[model samples]
Target: MHNPPRILAVDDVAENLEIVFVRLQAHGYEIITAADGEEGLARAREQKPDLILLDIMMPKLDGISVLRELKHDESLGFIPVILLTAKADRADVVAGLDAGADDYLTKPFDQSALVARVRSMLRIKALHDLVQDQAEKLAEQTKELAAFNATLEARVSEQVGEIQRMSRLKRFLSPQIADVVAASGDAQSLLESHRREVTVLFCDLRGFTAFTETAEPEEVMRVLNDYHEALGELIDRYEATLERFAGDGMLILFNDPLPCDKHTERAVRMALDMQATIKAHASVWRKRGHELGFGIGIALGFATLGRIGFSRRFDYSAVGSVTNLASRLCDEAKSGQIIIQTRAFHAVEGLFEARELEPMTLKGFRRPVEAFEILGAMKQEEKSAEA
Candidate 1:
């Protein structure tokens, strides 16, 4: 709405139009005059005036017809219209009001009343414009809010899915190592191919193949469950990364994915705990008439470790001579024996009592691999000092 409201005055008589134009224009109003109803509609459409004064009797179209046309048009419907009728009859006045005229005036207009009515209509139009503008802004803000909520929902869903996947991975990872993997900014970076000196321990039951051949499927599962439950606790206790467990054999790593202090000593301790645990389980198996023995081989050296296989099927694994040597040594070990190559035995020497074995050529190695059988660990006080 402008400071000086624009008004349209339509009359077939030239004298009436001149009077309205002169009077309103003198009172700080912009007046647009039209000679007939059709001409008034054209001027109203062009100017979009704040108020329209339409004459009842005009050529081409009457005031009631013009008012009806304006009321039906969405864009022009809300503009206030005042009807000018000379009849002074109640019927014509009612007809004008019924046709959506805001107010009406008789011929020989009163100048004071005309100004007051124009001021009132202008005030209404200004308030309506303000309300419409605010409504449009509110609608736009609501749209923006909906978009933001949709994006937030998607982000939350993605995060929840990631947590679910991490929970599934926890099935195979030690709790201590699982915490590290979860805290890392990029879990993939931890699995990317890299070479590092890691302590690899390979272990399996001594008579597992024979026992499985003779034992029922349920019995095999029962033994394996008991075996894993016992060893699984110790594995987590030592914070060693359990790479993979296949039926009985488990390959573990230390000083990898995240660094561990005195990794060699830790591996040896875990191996000793495992041997002791298996010894207790052996008596149970013996009672059931199903004999099983646990053996472990530990080796320390540089190895390549990373995620292996395609997108869906994969694992974080270690591959190199170190892993091979540990597996081969485990193959050569007797029931209840924990064997170690010279490289690893030397690393954690004096921490445990081990007997040197006669040099024997192991599979896949050109020279005889120097090895030792761990007999026992040092006293608790001395081991604590080593820690």
Candidate 2:
């Protein structure tokens, strides 16, 4: 866009300068004149003009020698150099070119021809500068994009980890159900459904208040973590959803998001496995002078499922008489016992080691409800025996 070419004309003769300077200036070029090769080289280095018209024969460094010096200096090497000479000697022209002069003009050169050559060289230089500027800008943009992509990738990985953590929290549900909820945008959708047949498991630690009083905080934490590890594994193995932890207790749910025909059977199996794990852990705790026990209650019924609370902080939980009844059953259970409602027992009786327990009136219920004790999981042959 800025087309005012800066030209440097070098010659020993004062008369020659007037002719060349006027020709280049009339052509709209900004002109700088030097009387000798030494002064020409000095101006070229300082001003970095678009083109240099160098006179071959001059005092204090010949034109060819000055051209060689400018060509050798890396910073000035790209400036176009044109050799001006009086003699049209073929050897001198060849020598001048080898010294790095871009073009050669004889002393009798026409004013129009000289002006044309200078314009052509300046045009080429302008084009080269434009390309270089574009290349530099492109390189800068590329680096910025690469840095942005790296930041975006890091944020995506963090989001993925958070999703996994939330899914793990939903251990009370089956892994399939947990995956479904995790895949959804929000858990609020879980609450807007009709009553569905689902199994609920309630587990409470026996004498937890006493343990908290007597045991060191770290020791209590260690014991609770040990229990959670064993129980978490079993829940995952059976593909159950862990609804939420209620202090020293855990509530498990099954057959909602991903319905399973054997929901009752799965609930019974989980209860039995939990009971067995406690017994095994109890023995180890007793040997170390520590006491640990658990009580489990299971029920089956239609539950109102949904997420509740503030939009920013909500919980996916079931709300109905059945959930409360299950909690009450856990309180009514004794240490090392698995209590299940009569209806739940009927659903999975053939698949579990069970015994009929006393009928009792549950709080808020109209009448006493029949109940059963789940001894443990029953093998296929054991189910046949019970049948």
Which candidate comes out best when scored by lDDT? 1
Cα lDDT of all candidates, in order? 0.88, 0.81
Which residue pairs clash within candidate 1? none
- TM-score winner: 1
**Distance from true location, Cα of 365 in model 2, Å:** 2.5
lDDT of 1 by residue, 292-385 (tens): 8888999999999887888667777888999999999999899989899999999988789889999979889999999999988978887788
lDDT of 2: 0.81
Cα TM-score per model: 0.69, 0.63
Model 2 regions more than 4 Å off: 1-107, 110-130, 133-176, 184-188, 191-194, 382-387
TM-score of 2: 0.63
What is the per-residue lDDT of model 2 for residues 1-387, given as tens digits with 9 covering 90 to 100? 235878889999999999988887887888899999889989998888888899999999899899989989988647788889999999999999998888988988988889888878887878877887898898899898899999989998978876765654464455556666667755445545557778888998888888889989988888888888888888887788777885679888878656777988888887888888888987887786687789998898988876556745656678787787788788888999989998888897677777887787778888887888888777878767767
